[model samples]
Target: MPNRRGLPQKWCHQELEVNEMAFSHRGNMTECKWKDKRDVYFLTTKHTASWTEVTVKAKGGPTKEIKPDRTLDYNLSKIGVNSNDQCICIILLIEEKPMKWWKKMFFHLMAHAMVNT
Candidate 1:
């Protein structure tokens, strides 16, 4: 799409993808290949394909594993559910004093409103 100046917009940016081969010296683009039975590919322009060590706990204790920065950041960013579900959970955590179901529901809604405010 063009702006008011009649210049076309930049439609492409070097971003990340899953399961990519080792590449270096590329412009803001990188890929991470995860070891799995299936062929996995990762690509990202915001990070490099270099491996960094992170701690992981197994049956035995804490151990270090090397993974790409893009992979780690992507993994960390995933918050499975939407904010609505999270809000519901947060608002329902208070223990009620033997109240009716409807009263409990009202309090829950009130809590949700307070949090939103």
Candidate 2:
């Protein structure tokens, strides 16, 4: 599936799954695989207590560590395509401010357009 940014919807789902799994496992072991045609990202549960620690391994050297905060909006925006013609998925964590309403609406429209296209 694809989202508005011409990117795979799977990426958004995978991130969400990782977030949920991290919170649920707490201090247990869990493993997840996220992949597209070009690359695969693996999340291996390391340790969890109040929070979870996961190691992210991609198809390259130097494994990247994923902290709980890494699942935040700052990271999710980096997962999608940049073109208007492509589908993209983005997760935004915004404050409950009123001024953001228009921005939200715009994103909603764009997402719909991308999906329908």
Q: How much does candidate 1 score in TM-score?
A: 0.45
Give the best candidate by lDDT. Answer: 1
The per-residue C-alpha lDDT of model 1 at residue 44 equals: 63
1-117 in candidate 1: lDDT tens per residue?
112232112322223334333443335655344542343455566766576778878899997776667667777676543565687777677654588999888888886777667
Report the alpha-carbon TM-score of model 2 versus the true structure.
Answer: 0.20
Mark the 10 consecutive residues where model 1 has the least summed lDDT.
Answer: 1-10
Candidate 1, residue 60: the lDDT equals: 92
Which of the numbered candidates is closest to the native, going by highest TM-score?
1
lDDT to native, each model: 0.57, 0.43
lDDT score, candidate 2, position 54: 54
Give the per-residue Cα lDDT of candidate 2 at 98. Answer: 61
- In model 2, which regions exceed 4 Å deviation? 1-49, 57-66, 69-85, 88-114
Report the backbone clash tally of model 1: 12
